[model samples]
Target: MPRWEPDARTRLEKAALELFAERGYDGTTVADIAERAGLMKRSFFRYFPDKREALFGGTPLLVGHLEQYVTEAPPGIRPWPLLVDALTGTARFFPEDRETARTRHRVVTANPELREREVLKTATLDDLLRDLLTARGTPPRQAAYLVRLALTMYEQAFTHWLTPADPEPDFTECVATAVGDLERVLGEWGDGG
Candidate 1:
């Protein structure tokens, strides 16, 4: 039997990111990631099905969290505010260390396949959020609009939060700022314009 290892999943993730940054995703293998993390290759499979999962393995958990947040929101809360709260709350799911997150972002953005995987993940989240909102009595059109806008805010916030050295603005704060920006833009457009 293999000895239990503490934080093996985190170690594998860090090692995979480092390797992906250094060798490019296509050049990095599961064996390389395991060796870099000082674990067996089988251990990698234990946590992830393949190399791509090193970057995207959290999508399911994230989706579950979002679904739960949307479904459990107060009955009086409107879709837009609920979405803002959900997006801001999701900041907890990401790593606090910005540099590590930046490196992972760089690795993913540099690879077309990884980028496509990312887009697909976003689409999956979009579908899930839309369905959750519609199920909760929000009109289908309103649900789709609010979800897409919220996702755009999330994307903007994520991009801002990844800025190289200026880390004062945390993820939640970034999301808030994105929401503010959206509100400002929409307000400027006015109700009848």
Candidate 2:
């Protein structure tokens, strides 16, 4: 058999996910993941702080991309469109491997600990989004509302993108659709619907 030859981080992440799937997240340890990956325990720490991070470690990079997009958006763009632009810019990180994405989603969803961590990560991203918007001179109250709306839209788009039934839209299209839905809902609500 050809040897599995992913890089150290990829190898560790793969091993962690496999172990998490086979033995449950709490049942798997960092050492176990490192051993499975054919590396030492310390090597695992070099890539991820702990097992949970192996799954969610990409958040900071994504948040950074969103912040950059917001920071560089053209002056006077409306809050909703700016938020959409930032979200769409971060779509680069969404995996094209649908099955792998689905598996990770299942693994995260199935574990309470992982779900809690996911919530924390989402909250962190929300804070970052609000801060970025405020730095761009968006009013604080508007930024707060926009932060929640943007995160809700992102979650909807991500969940839709991960489902295997339909031919999935491009990540940006998913974001656009979510934003459009939010706009329509807001319009209807404003009209007393």
Candidate 3:
């Protein structure tokens, strides 16, 4: 066995997922996760604050990747496409391990706490994204709205892509479909009137 319980974070996350699926969120304990990981209880704390965190611990990894993607965009590129590319980066992150992704979706959807944590993470991420857009010359109010819209599209695209019955799964295409759907929904009031 490796000293210091290497990759303690990933190990804890995996162990927590298995326990949560088996015992349900409220029923699982930190010590239980640490034990399953063959780690000391203190090591679990070094990784996550509590069992609830493991439910959506991958969130920070996603946010950091998004920030990196946004920061790398050519200076003049606007926020929407930047947002799309960031969401697309997950195409690599996901489908990397389909079984893991499927199990994650199932766990997140099944538990109310997990779902709420996911939503909170989204809201926090939107705030950070909007800040970056504003830094890139977007006006504050518009930056906020645009980030919110892009994130909504990204979210719907993810759901569509991950739905087990999806006939043609593709988040990028789903994003375009979501944007088109939004346009149609809002275009009803127009005639350019």
Candidate 4:
């Protein structure tokens, strides 16, 4: 048997992602992942409820950072900027393991079930953002719109940041560029009116 190691959670995640990439998400099993990580099946269950959860288990961390950032932002900060700050703040939770991220992205994108789970996770974050904004005195409708726009920009920026040609290694730069793009688009739209 392979020697036991520390950082069981990280090891399991890396192993699972690799197996998912090799065998496809549906074809991979908990035992396969655990075995690859040199762990027992029960050890895998301790870290993740299922194979899908292994990929998405960090959602709570991301949501928590966003909530904290939004709630603690300077009182006078505008809604859009607050949203940008909150979104960017959550980027730090992503691991710097680019290849693992790429493989996990491929697996999640390829599976319909995984895609649905991803959408659900995004919606949860959207709801959290909306609630945070509303508690800070924004109207419900405006909060909803702001949350959607911010999430859209975040998604675009994250995708751009992950691209091979993206020169910047930091995720925040991509987010800043996305925010600028959003501002330019809105400016053009307002001018056309």
Candidate 5:
């Protein structure tokens, strides 16, 4: 075994996803993932504290991205546009390759534990977003409502972006489409439909 290997983190992530998909999340062990990545168990710990974290290693970075975007947004920007900008800015954190994303989504959704983890991670994000907005002078109630809308927009955009027939839809464009759909819905209510 080499004393040092570059990109060990990426290698381990790919290995873990492959194993999780193949052997199922519970069936796959930390040792199995490390070995598949051509690393040792110790190396796995160096990257992720546990097996479940391998699928969520990017959570902190994602949280930080939102934090930075919200904090640095232009002074005159309203909460809704800020929310949209913050959410769309996260496009870089996700995989450009749709299949890799689909596989990870599959692995997470297929397991109850993983699904719970996903929910917890999402809640953490939503809470932070609301807090960030409130900190930036948005009313607490409005911040909370914006967070909920952002969550819906993100989910809708991601699902549409992951569609198999799209053949390379841009995540940002998908988000714009969701925003448009939301506007259309709100417009209907305004017209007393």
Candidate 6:
């Protein structure tokens, strides 16, 4: 068996999204993707199961990198900070191809099929994050809560990044700011916490 090549997967993703934008996902086919990628149709099938996955090509890779980098973060680091780091570091995973990113975002947002995968991926990462926090010595209950909050912060961060008026950051600073706000709220509500 051959090792997976980032170059190959990236090519497929770029090709798939381009064609989908030009002719709609329903209008595209695997052959179109392969031709766009400048790859053989056989090679395309070797990498992705079908056309839709070409559009979703990088997600599993993104999730794996997040889990690995985040879980490996030093135990001394607080979980929220660790999450911010992980999300930030994972930024490069998406590529600087703005048109591709924006187009893929629109396709994923608009497509029922892609939305289901995105939601499931979120759920899976949330569970993984809770586990990572607990292993870092957060109380199990606290870890679960913190993971949910951090994910919510990430969501806010993503929304802010998408706003046309907002500044561009590889990873949104607003995410960490949201976390700080949450911390302030928790401190104010302290049951001697």
Predicted candidate 3 versus true structure: per-residue lDDT over 1-193, tens digit per residue = 5558668888888888888888888888889999999998888888788788876676777888888888878898877778777777767666465567777788888989889988899888888899888888889999888888888877778777766663665667777788787677668756563
Residue-level lDDT for 136 in candidate 5 = 88
Top of the candidates by TM-score: 5
Q: Which stretches of model 4 miss by more than 4 angstroms?
A: 1-5
> Candidate 4: how large is its RMSD?
2.0
Better of 2 and 4 by TM-score: 4
Give the residue spans of candidate 2 off by over 4 A.
Answer: 1-6
lDDT per residue for candidate 5 within 34-135, as digits (tens), equals: 999999889999889899999999999989999999998877899998888888888898886778999999999999999999999989999999999899
* TM-score (C-alpha) between model 1 and the true structure: 0.92
Which parts of model 3 are misplaced by more than 4 Å? 166-168, 189-193
TM-score for each candidate, following the candidate numbering: 0.92, 0.91, 0.85, 0.92, 0.95, 0.80
In candidate 5, stretches whose alpha carbon ends up further than 4 angstroms from where it belongs are 190-192
lDDT, candidates in the order shown: 0.88, 0.84, 0.80, 0.87, 0.91, 0.76
TM-score preference between candidates 2 and 6, better one: 2
What's the lDDT for residue 176 in model 4? 85
Q: What is the alpha-carbon lDDT for the whole of candidate 5?
A: 0.91
lDDT of 4 at 27: 94
lDDT tens readout by residue for model 1, 113-147:
99999999999999999999999899999999999
Rank order by TM-score, top first? 5, 1, 4, 2, 3, 6
Root-mean-square deviation per candidate:
1.8, 3.0, 2.5, 2.0, 1.3, 4.2
Give the Å error, residue 16, model 2: 1.0
Candidate 4, pairs of clashing residues: none
Number of clashing residue pairs, candidate 1: 0
- The 10 consecutive residues of candidate 4 with the worst lDDT sum are 161-170
In model 1, what lDDT does residue 49 have?
A: 86
